[model samples]
Target: MQQPGYFAEDVLPLLASLPTWPQPSRKGATRDAEWILWVKMRMWNRLKAQFTGIIESDFKEQGLEEEDLAWIAGGLVDAGSATSTANFHNIVLYLAACPDVQATAAKEIAAVVGDDRAPAMSDVSPLPYVWACIEVLHRNTMPPWAIRHFTDADVTHKGFVSPKCPAVVCDTVALQFDEERYPDSFAFRPERYLGHTEFAGDYAAMADAQPRDHWTFGAGWRVCPGTRPAKSNLALMLANILWAFEIRPPTGAEKGGKGSAIDLSDDAFDMYPLRQARPFKAGFCLRLMLQEGLTVEAAF
Candidate 1:
């Protein structure tokens, strides 16, 4: 789970660059999915270009004007500098380096996805545990606020007037942690999204009707067009990393700090530029088949 800021700082920029990409002619809502896919592909391509640019920039610092074109021309290398690539890289790096959510994710992956094959986009859909992990990550490290926008027409909230063109801002973190909506709101219980429970019904409805509450992505008509693709990419990255490594707290250390317990409160925002996370440690290792060739590994 790459945290909410990663989407805003990295993924969104790459997605923003993609609208200019050439689109095939199509009519009506018939081609909606195709158009979405086209935009996604364009976003990914632009992200790759941006990542390449970052690599070039880093080389410039070392007195190298350009990356080795031969090496670069090789398709789909894991060079980690561009927007989406960097976002994924940061996530993988954090999972490898951070102790909190990383270990839990690895355990879930090992129990569900296994290591023989890396996770694919399709696999993410059936993996409720993985989805819950993503949700927790978002709740814990989301940006303090969403971008402010003005409504084109007047709106009312609780009988109060929100006059037309009034500036409106949404508090993302507050909404996710609201206890009335999310019971035991501060706890990192992935089960909240699993099984056929009351909240699960709400989750299904939200998945079907309104996805805005999944506010790691924004809202309304201008919401992230890259939401589906970004999620696919995120799921694949998380799954592969979990399948490949084991995460755990460092020896002689507690889950979060020296004699301090893991805090799921809003206070856990220190590691980000906008919010710093308390220092934590974890270890990683390759998982081996434990029984009769049946094993579970994490996927995104």
Candidate 2:
């Protein structure tokens, strides 16, 4: 059992006494489960040791006296919160603005989830279109650049050589929008991920060989371990939101012939120029929260 909530209440308050600015607010609703798991299972000793010599004795990092545990905790918090917000916001904008995609997802949800109380994690597999939609959102709107990385050793690309030890920024645009990987990368078509219709053969092979789950969660050791929870949150939120409401453009706006296709410019202010849709108003109407186990005759 992943009893992270209990660990947070019992374990975290004691760590603030250490010499770090502060551990981010890791309340029940706002904590990362993996982070808590690591702290509970792996790093419990450091917390128990506090300023004691147990840390100094066991883990000598580059001959340093003690490890900075607070910074580690902060990094986990930083990774989980902001990126999750951006991902969820981007998904909502795409779903609301693209009615075709939204309809497809809703139809899938209706068929699989079926006038349910609410969508659950188990329903994710049955909703592969929903999965593709999420992937498209990631591929289309990942951060303009990835976070900085330090070079471990000298590396050469083609004829040019980057020095052995300078920090380098990844060309996120080139990598994400690689024509070989994502044909017509600019267009928001989830079917490319599903490899259906016109996007058969190479695209399908690419989709299967290595699905572009995107570098937003990052890669390898620095990878965000919160992906499971993040996907769950996104999937459930999208399923329930689309299931419960009909999203429409604001009143008086001329919604081009197919009013569903709205302009999704990132005009909203962000702490670091985030990829968010502009503040366009969407009118949501109350739709039937379909009930399960009640047939037509039974309901009547």
- TM-scores for candidates 1 onward, in order: 0.51, 0.63
TM-score of 2: 0.63
RMSD of 2: 12.3
Tens digit per residue, CA lDDT, model 2, 228-285: 6666566677787777766654443364533444565444323244565544555565
Task: Please state every model's RMSD to the true fold in angstroms.
Answer: 15.0, 12.3
lDDT of each: 0.51, 0.58
Q: Model 1 misses residue 255 by how many Å?
A: 13
lDDT of 2 at 228: 63
RMSD of 1: 15.0
- Model 2 misplaced stretches (Cα beyond 4 Å): 1-67, 156-160, 179-181, 195-213, 219-222, 253-261, 265-273, 289-300
Which residues of candidate 1, in runs, are more than 4 Å off?
A: 1-112, 156-159, 195-213, 252-267, 271-280, 289-300
